[model samples]
Target: MQRSIVRLAIGAAVFTLFALHSAGQLRWRLLDRIETFTYDARMRLPAQAQSQAPIVIVDLDEKSLAAEGQWPWPRDLLADLVDRLFDDYNIRVLGLDMTFPEPDGQSPSRLLSRLSDSAVGRLPGFAAASAAVSAQIDHDRRFAEALSDRAVVMGFVFKQSVKSDEAPEQGVLGPPLFAVEDAVDYVAPHGFTGNLQGLQAPSGLGGFFENPLVDDDGVYRRVPLVQAYQGRVYPSLALSVTRAALGGAPVSLLFDPPAKRRSLNLEAVELGPLEIPVDEQVAAWVPYRGGYRSFPYVSATDVLRRSVEPGVLRDAIVLLGTTAPGLLDLRVTPVARAFPGVEIHANLIAGMLEGQIRKKPSYYLGLEVVELALIALLIGLLFPRLSPLAGAGLAAGVALAVVGGALLAWQLGAILPMGVPVVFTLFLFLAQQLFGYFVESRGKREISRLFGQYVPPQLVEEMAARPQVVSMEGDIRDMTVLFSDVRDFTSISERLDARSLSDMMNQFLTPQTRCIQQYRGTIDKYMGDAIMAFWGAPLPDESHALNAVRAALDMVAAVQALNPQFEARGWPAIRIGIGIGSGDMRVGNMGSEFRVAYTVMGDPVNLASRLEGLTKVYGVPIIISEITREALPSDWAMRELDCVRVKGKERPVTIFEPLGPKEELSSSVRESLARHRGALQAYRGARWNQAEAAWLELARREPERRLYGLYLDRVRQLRVTPPPVDWDGVFVFKTK
Candidate 1:
């Protein structure tokens, strides 16, 4: 009886842990990745319900390359292909999965323009002679005219800037049908590379060809229907082609009223007669038919040669794109590794047209959580009360139930995660069956196994080998603590659905954790989108501050690299503010009896959190307290920010920004730093005029830099309200 009670207790505890993690109270990235793999497996189930779709691809394949020469094929050839699709084949709609960012260089008009600019066209009869040839040989003008008043859709791409505040203007665009409320939360493209005006103007309908978003595994899954660029919304190539096919009907976005409180949640997009479901980001899953060549593909050369059969393409919507390996147009998709990118759009268009695309909405998460809890409860209660044989039968039954339920959902065209619940149920069943056998060895074994999940492999190994060194007792140590929080996270969260948001956060936080761990720092905990980490615990480092500073700088650079992926994913480009502080603090495994964590705590740790909050105020990405700056190497380039008392702290402390190694500083930056230092001195010495003049010059030189402008504002305000003669140069902050 006692053994049964103990076994039940352990099984329930285990089930609770796994069940909570499955419910998303605690995230397990490995399980999430596994869920994607499971989804990929289920998605491979052949979609046999629909007939051959009405979409055909005009592939610029290897055969076309061999017959028609290399890509950037003369605009005349493209113009010929376009005319053939609409005129000869009677295709319903023509979509170009390509862009023409510049005028065709091989055109006779360009040659004539060059000649007119030089001494050649200036000759007596040469000008008139070339003018006649130029008008006839202007291929772009010919292509533009061919597309005018036709069922044609052109493609363009959006390029996001690394510096979020500055965006370059390019290309003309048509506005989207719907306005996204709280537009800041939407994934917005800051800049774009678009088609030439001559070509774009005549197409009358076009959309961006770029994905700019992908799954966490870098596989093409969902494609966005619309993207916001500089407050204007534009559709994608797939959406545009569908719209054109539907007689140019404007798309209607259906939103969930409940989610509108956070930010608008796009439930579905309505075309003329078809309604397609999409996630909050306005993206839909590509309902792949099978592997590559799932749709009919006719070579562009065949279309141009007029060698294709009559009714094969008649009334079919044809998308023009390349499949040549050298063209680099192939992409990794859930269905195929080397699928032509064009087919992805075709699948989406066809799936939406047929209403076969599976949708996993936000409400599905609640359903999954409930299902997991019930299954976990059943396993926990039944397994403990049954004999070994009976328990085995019950466990198998539960496994079959979970898998059967998942398969039923799949057959009905919905994807719910089954890996976690199935794995959790089986684990508990086996653990209970083996509990009596491993009773003597379970104590140390379980501790080692559980600890291994949280700490680094090296630390776990040492703790297992020397158990005396591991304890829950507290100790004081001089350590460096770092705090990092995503800027505008609330808005970011509002842009994505639960699963997509989770995947995006995982994609972002994984690299950051690597940066800290790479610098030998231990992560204390994650507070939502913020990370709290420390160096010099369990193992002490004399240069913990220097290591923390290096990690901070690397994290900023890492985020810069991550922005492009984020931009591509239609998720918001993110920025992080980092704060680092080094001083004596408490370090140990601290928590209640139920759950303890290896972490650090002290005034210095609290101050690090406070400093991170100031990054937004300072308009900088990284900030550090004076103690951290003092511990750094002399070669480090540091700029004094301010001497202020934080809201919760009593004493005033100085803050600084580290600008990497001194040797790497540019000459212009070095000069600005010199001027900045002089300005700081003048401001502290009560020479308002000198301070104002210095800051004005710095602000003019770097107009985008807010620090210089901030100082200018301060100097101007102080001049109007001069400080008392005995006043110190300390600023007091009243909020954290």
Candidate 2:
């Protein structure tokens, strides 16, 4: 029973580390995305559009084209319309939805044989002297030139992986118009902007990714900010237009990684006056003024040819797009079933100028952390001590209070994280109850195994007031494992008497091993001076690898940082050897059924020990199996520590040594790392003296290291009593 309690105490200490580290990482990612998800389309589109004034649209209708005759209108006719807007009505910009990729069909063939062809009248390089452009071509072409000269935002696409049979001259309008919310590679995955029937040449373009946002009920939600395409991020059509209207400021999507809050960037810079609440991906619900065609749709022929009165264009930004049945630009919208696309632009402009923006802030992560702590603390403290009914009542009250708190925070301009507190609270609470049922004693042991490495002993005791989460019967789970051993302990043991060895072990190994348990690593067993542990078992730990790998590093750190103090007291300094690996492992009681001992058993466990043994051969402290290295977060740098098979293994396992926290390692340290690897490689190649020189240098920096001293003694002995002639520089261990 006493032995069980000791194990429990150790497990609890380690278990707490497992809880805190995983809690920190998860709270960062999940909560961050949750915060950004609040940004909506209804608000942003309006804020930007209204800010850009003097905009208008021209729509295609059956009546306008019928009266104007078959579709392909002549350049002279377009030129005439341009003259009217510029000369007759004094409108400043005349954007065209039409392209001049083809020659004006209605130009008078023989009229331009001499000097009559103007730049606007002919295609860029027509062989024949272009004839006088027809009324249609003359009107539209002239209008395009005038608009082009008025600082109008020109639109065109880079044609990413476009179709081979597509018209070479045909183009979509604009570049990726906005930044991604949490984008690392800058891919636009949520927009789609299609081309019109070559109408008013685009002033600016957006909406290429244009994916519809669907709510929980499978209904449409908000508009997305950008579209990720071909691994590149692009801007939405609304964003492009807003950028153009706002005098061509670069537009980017600002994403906060921790909070997942999203806002718009104008002029390729930080988000200005427009702060729209969006998801971490910047996809949001687009509340419409009503469905499609809610805006007043006028015939293009009416506006361009002066058929409509002057007052009708009064201070209104017009958008030109199609509504004719054959064209199919018509679609269902909030206001109407057959909305004109042009009016969508106008509405956005109106909304922007009116300052209709909604904001989602970056505090979302903190809220989740605080809430989770609250729930975990509450459930742990209350459930065990209170009556079942009372516990149930308290839980219900807490739920109501939490929901109310969210609403209250929202009202006060604070968007608190909503789901995490509830989730963590429920998980911790339920796990404890279930733990109590199966093996309360074992559960306590399990807890010590997890948090013992990362937190203080006192803090762990405070947390013990809550529920226990350990179980004697382990469940299947993915985990990160760490294994470590003292180099040459067998020889070192031969030299000391049993009592001296025991005292030395207590002096050195006790504190060193305690650090591992402090990091919430599950202590598997101790083989003399060796310690074996794993992370992310007995509970779900998404950051299992990160926790275990980092804990191994921390163990080395704790030992090194204290070694000098040990030297001053005439005690031998401690040096550790560690190996880390991550993967699925079976963990449970593994001894004889009569005397079962809880432990993890799998390839990962073996590999972890192997990795640790390799550290001595490679002259480094922290070695990780390849799988564990790959599973770690990308922030840490690990040096490859050569590939080798242990005595009983066939396949070679690639081993790596973690230096320290990546941020603190310097050039001098890196140089030492480089020299150390080179010397270790030489030692493996039977260059014993070269290996000896490397140790000498390392000792210059770190004198009296336990592992290094062991190696130096072995080398001296080998020089005098060498191995057989066939000896390759391989060291083999007889037991685990």
Candidate 3:
């Protein structure tokens, strides 16, 4: 419970940190960058519907420059192009994306007037003839006449900074949209470059083409629709064009209630029937349709030659701008790098007219805080109770839901914060997972330290998985016990020095212990040169007897394999005898209070020890009691040794020697086993002559065979001193 509280506190702290950042109490640059990235990604997605607003770009491209000469084309040509757009094609409104800051220097009247003041003025007919030509070819006057009484919006630039000695203003600015006393915040410009006086005076419509709100990353994602200058508000070129296209509708600034206006809380820009959303800085989000060339482009040369499609420009709002490299009008936008600046204004004008400008309102910060809080509460309360896998799934689901919600809000013309909530969910999940890992690690370490020495490492690991099921108290369980001891270890230990003896013992016992553990048997303790172990303890195994038997066989092989190395080291070759038995036994931690050990004890354990002693008598490496044999699988190949009563045990228990798996027994071994069984049967039935003959034959076949010789001698004794008829065929050992 305390751990859960710590986990919750950690999660809450994380949420609080992010919430503070969202609520403007703190700043995180990473979150801002990620938010901008997500915004760009959304802008690049395929639009559901193409913008239906009829907007066209009159590109003064390289082709137009080739046909109509270089930039700064004479004002007479511009006048002709304007006439073509307004008269022939019947365009709705024309917005000049380029500014004319000075009068046309190539005007014929200015040139002729200058010439008239020169020595040519002294000629008789020079002044009269120059006057006639000047009246007919005055380019500036003709260009101004074309703009008169036409719905044309001229473009201008706003300077963000100006030097003390540099000029602060140029040309003539259009009428302001609002006074400086208006109750709204706006971007303020230091200076501006407006169109020429004669040009702007005739049209009486102009807008600033500069974007003061370009992001810090140098990407143009949003543009200020209106800026404050010289105590008056002015609209952007796109806003001016949109207003002119809508029959000169008046623009009004919308805002929240006066009480909610804490920090530049302007909401939208109201233009007649269209309500264009604007951020706090009075900037509108550019709803880019795609990359460059999203809108129709008509070359200036084509407009001049009247070679465009008949209906392409009819009633369309046209923007005259140059895409030539020398003109330098390219901008980096969210959808495309090096996008034509004219298309950016075109996209804005189209979006404003369609009422599709996305919004980032002042309440978005509050919404983000709420979203983060709700995500934190849901994850924090549920994560502690869930498993690791379930917790990961919950985190993923929450992240997906957050992103999906943000996308849905984007579709509805609202851009909620997308990166913070998703990142917050991920960080919170990691915190909880790390905390849970550390907490669980403590329990695992305790289990390992306590049981690591007694059981195999794998069994200790298994016990750690479900620690609730592990018990240390003594209890009775049906299990298998194994006892192994080196043959003649007392003599071998005396032959070596103490250090060498210890090394030999370590070398001999390490592999033997590993063999026992390899088959899932747990080592109870190492008794000098002997090892005592059991199976089905600490962790349960139904096949305990089979595992013990297999381990005994492997242990004998392990000793035999170590003999050659021992001989090379001038030590005696080693042999080990292992005995196994299976029955109900008291198993678990048992000892005095000062030194408790997890061990097992019962009659079956004693039986296994006694069997280990008997292996030297039978000259065999492994022996198993009858109960253990019965517990093993039927496919095991074992040879019956005897039914004997060791010292201190009244009832006789049958024992056998394990050969190998049934499928692995050689034919000769099978024949020897069959003959030995026949001999045992005959002897048990008291057929003295037949038993004697069979034992003699087995003894003669292998002179070094101790079991056959011992049986033969027993047959002879039984023949000489025959007991009562009720006597059972059980061998009784007086000494162990």
**lDDT score for candidate 3 against the true structure:** 0.88
User: Least lDDT summed over 10 consecutive residues: which range in candidate 2?
Assistant: 41-50
lDDT for model 2 comes to: 0.56
Better of 1 and 2 by TM-score: 1
Please state the error at residue 452 of candidate 2 in Å.
43
Superposed model 1: Cα runs more than 4 Å off: 1-12, 15-25, 162-169, 182-185, 258-265, 434-436, 440-736
Best by lDDT: 3
What tens digits encode model 3's per-residue C-alpha lDDT throughout 197-296? 9999999898988888888889999999999988898999999999999998989877677455433667888999889998877889999998888899
TM-scores of the models, in the order given:
0.57, 0.37, 0.65
Rank list by TM-score: 3, 1, 2
- Kindly list the per-residue Cα lDDT of model 2 for residues 544-583, writing each as its tens digit: 7877876776777777777797668545566778888878
Model 2, position 181, has a per-residue lDDT of 40
Determine the C-alpha RMSD for candidate 1 after optimal superposition of all C-alphas.
38.2
Over 562-678, each residue of candidate 1 has an lDDT whose tens digit, in order, gives 999989978889999999898999988788899888788999999999999999988899999999999999999988888889997888999999998999999998999899899
